[model samples]
Target: MSKHNDQIAELLTDDSFVRWINGDANTLEQRKWNRWLEEDPANIAVVRQAKKLNELLWFEEEQPNTQKELKRLESALIEERTLPSEGINRGGMGMALWTKVAAAIVLLITVVGVIRYAHWGPKEPEATEQPIMATTQTGYGEVKRVTFFDGSKIILNANSKLTYPKTHQGGDMQVELQGEAYFNIAHKSGQEQRLFSVLTAEGKVAVLGTKFNVNTHSEGTEVVLEEGKVKVQKTNPKDRANKPYIMSPGELAMLFSNKSNIKIQNVDSELYTSWKNFELKFKNTPLHRIADRIEEIYGVEVEFSNKSLREIEFSGSAPNKNFEVLLEGLRTLLKIPVTYEGNTIIFGS
Candidate 1:
């Protein structure tokens, strides 16, 4: 038998879970499902895969656009299957793992067929099945915790919006993100390991399972790895010739939208990821970079009177505090001048 066969089978056949997957769960069933997720964290990844298959099944059955999606998947799979296996001498992503998973399922679509394969998960719901989707948006001063049926949770930062399907596709997961979020991705093992991926305008980050942070804006996309590894692929047409960068724990990947080159550096993960804990930390970080982050988090603007202010590096941690108090702490800690004008903060004389 294949790895994870028993656990996967149980989840796919669970009566209450099946109702929830097909979006037919009653109030009591929904409550029970949530309780099941809480009872054992390890069950999260298994449940997530089941959800993905459910969404794919529903989409193929009800959506008018299924043909278009299937065609794309077929092309991708054919292309992906023909590519020679390149040895990984380095750390980053090769061919996208998501594509491979999609291809594996596509073969099933052709053999067992789409409709028959769709029924592999559970008994079809009598009610019509539609594609599952949900979105969460947070205010500038707010942070929200989004829990996926897979048990993976996302801590969405202020002024951010995240859109995700109700379930993953083919047991591989993908998400579209705008703004910033820290992901505590649930890990899948056995056959499904190494299938979690994030897509941004700048590029894509793929991993089997890991803790990481992703930030995207007009400037570019930044990925910081706290634990585990990730493959960061550059998506620019101009940089198509560039090699994908693989990052290990304690490393950072910066992909600029305007340039084809990617920059990699070592960083203190706490400096980049501690925001979720209401802690701001720095290690010889420049004031201007600090100002930029303050703007992102507080929804305010910051200006330095002199260009030199942008290059001053200091080391410290700022306790999670209100905007004004944080600026005051900076001023006192650095012995520098800081004044506020409405929502904007100006530094240096």
Candidate 2:
């Protein structure tokens, strides 16, 4: 095997390469992989097979634990490369280390194909570790609390769903969110620390330990950090030019749905975060947005009959009060006629 071939052989065991194969590599790492493939045409096939093997092992969420089989396949390939080769036809190709790797991948894929299609047809193979799936959801006018095994707590707001796996192979503690939720992540210090991430349609919020609120809607995604620090990324794949926002305490990151702009601003974090405590606090917050929050929190439809009222701003606080008291309070504050109908509140006339 040539030096380059040895490098290629060593690449299979490289963790970064494995991460790239699993779609976890950052941009620089992805570029490095691309550059490596461009340097040598043969590197393309090498990486392709490596990725195929990785995808196969991670194909299904409840896939059989095939880690041992992968290691055995790699080991067997190296051992077989030492066989007698005086007149061994390498299929008009050199007997390089890369060739052995490609051959081994093919052999392993064929054997696994037989086992998967024949033995495990229609039924998923049993595995030592089961797929971890847990979820918490809240309907309109409702709130829910979920505690993870790692002692982290999530206070989900109305019209929200949170789903998470137990933990990832690389010590990743991740969750997927739609709508709104407040996270009070437990600090997993020292060796117990895990990489925690909150993924949404807009992007993701990553932190080791922090208290944050994530609100993802059709309009945009908002991440407000109350304690500690977090990185909120605008990770829509179609828009790659947006940079990720690193938010400190009392900071908010907003990624608008229509644009690739990520804006960070210092804010009264409590106003955006106090919902979990059944408090609605505002600091000259726009009336339209506040109405949206009111509807979300109480399942009551709030609408400004006129466009002018929508642009009005309000500054006050309201506990988890019923609809009439809240409507009368707002009417007194803004001096507007508040009409309460069945399940709907209108602030016009």
Candidate 3:
């Protein structure tokens, strides 16, 4: 018991051992502990016990019964130590060692418990008000139409998710979007005109009765207005002081997350909004953009072995309802090598 007490005291006094147990060890301290374990494998049980004790003391909501837990831990350590080592029975030595370690284990538990109680203790969780949210998700190659109580309609494209409040109490009709979706926001006139905002990872699109197509991708969020008007704002912290970009009919707004500016352009609305009709219309669209759409819809990674293959443009319409049909058309029209390896679609042999 005195021997065990001496070992525990020595380890507690060692800053490296204490830091390692507390998971605060730097790279050098971690290497030091690893070397100690490799040099003396017998110390593994002590290290594990110290880690478990620390976890039980800190993460546990209710105070643990120190006496009972200590006894169980002591028994586990004794059993682990007594196991046969190197084809020889070390049961007798393990029992004697554990008996010597009992007092040391108790001292460690007492000291750690006192410190924990003095500095940190379980806290009562504060109550938080949470809004009731309703979410709609579409799987790969599947399109879904969601209708809201205010007669607003949203057509979610494949592999997209939309979350909004279950009911509108009338401040701002806000919803969050991930992936691509086409919006036909209901027109509100007079005092009933509430701003309809679509939140995305890149930015927010605020509209008052408009038809638009929004696609969220790795680069950022793209918004193409079919009719009416919409305001686009980038969520970048540096651009927070800047005013939102306004878009009119036949205008496309791109909100880049990494950049502090929003890009607005005039584009053919059909090129972006035709997907809702189970087809995709491309007009001199680059292969990389097509690959982005394919990846976004089918949830498959598209890679081009040749960098120049991504620059090739395609001008045609393809059936988007069937993924294989679209890939077949791409292969036939492009006359390039398209191969499927697991979930990845590789172009150029």
TM-score against truth, every candidate = 0.59, 0.58, 0.60
Q: What does candidate 2 score on TM?
A: 0.58
Worst 10 residues of 2 by lDDT: 112-121
Candidate 3 global TM-score: 0.60
Poorest 10 consecutive residues of model 1 by lDDT?
111-120
In model 1, the clashing pairs are: 44-150, 52-168, 92-246, 194-208
Candidate 1 to truth, TM: 0.59
Model 3 residue 210 CA deviation (Å) reads 0.9
Instruction: Give the alpha carbon lDDT tens digit for every residue of 97-151 in model 1.
Output: 4224423432333322121112212334642253464555554545668877767
Q: Which regions of candidate 3 fall more than 4 Å away from where they truly are? A: 1-131, 236-241
lDDT of 1 at 313: 94
**lDDT rank, highest first?**
3, 1, 2
lDDT of 2 by residue, 59-162 (tens): 44666659977787677667556633322221211224433443343244322211111111133344324447555554455566877877789987765667
In model 2, residue pairs whose N, Cα or C atoms come closer than 3 Å (at least 3 residues apart or on different chains), thus clashing, are: none
Model 1 global lDDT (CA atoms, 0 to 1): 0.71
Top model number, lDDT: 3
| Predictions in order: lDDT | 0.71, 0.70, 0.73
